[model samples]
Target: MSHAIAADQREHRRLQLAPTIIRADIEQDGKSREGYLINVSLGGAFLSIADPPAKDTTTTDLHMLLPWGIGECHVQARTVWEQTDDQERAIGAGISFIDLSEDASNQLQSYLDRFKELSIEITS
Candidate 1:
């Protein structure tokens, strides 16, 4: 199954990053699980983990360190979708930011914009 979102359906363009290890603390149902951020956009992100929350899970709290010495960003997210490998192992999930403070949003956008500019320079 393809995980690609249709271009017309996406609200924002996703920025693929180099393999950067960003540790994340995901909270749900009064429990917390560790994961890593894979890719991100202004709207959402893909999180990789050994055990993902149930599909029925609606919301989660995520705390993760931003790259480039940007410090940490926190937001409440809604589980939009999930993916599993053939072995039934949990691979990752797509989470949309449901609640983000203005400061946090600005911080994230700045990081993404910097990354975008760097990518353009590298490609050119």
Candidate 2:
């Protein structure tokens, strides 16, 4: 596949996830907590954290469940943006993956492909 397609396949888009479907144990700045993964791609994932969003430029270790029973993926990532509620209360954050492995990339791609197919099926 071309490099561009790889990047697009893992683009950080939003997807509403069922609770406990993909659990994420987030470790950052020496603190450890847990969050549910809202959406995930090769590039990054948007995590719906119950705790307050971390500070800017935070590097996080994301341990999560991949789609379609592909298995769990543990990758390092950095916070790029944040999502807040109407009251500006800290809600969730969008993270960009730092370095990903080839195996992990393929697994993520497969997971994404499954989602794409499911979306089409739902629409059709």
Once superposed on the true structure, which residue ranges of model 2 sit more than 4 Å away at CA? 1-21, 52-55, 84-90
Deviation from native of the Cα of residue 66 in model 1, angstroms = 0.7
Model 1 — which ten-residue stretch has the worst lDDT?
A: 8-17
Output the TM-score of candidate 2. Answer: 0.70
lDDT for position 44 in model 1: 70
lDDT of each: 0.75, 0.70
Candidate 2 local lDDT, 1-124, one digit each (tens): 8998567555434432222236788888788999876566667667778754554665688787775779988888776677777476548887777778887777777777787778779889
The estimated TM-scores of all candidates read 0.77, 0.70
User: Which regions of candidate 1 deviate over 4 angstroms?
Assistant: 1-8, 13-21, 87-90
Highest-scoring model, TM-score: 1
Residues forming the 10-long window of minimal summed lDDT in candidate 2: 12-21
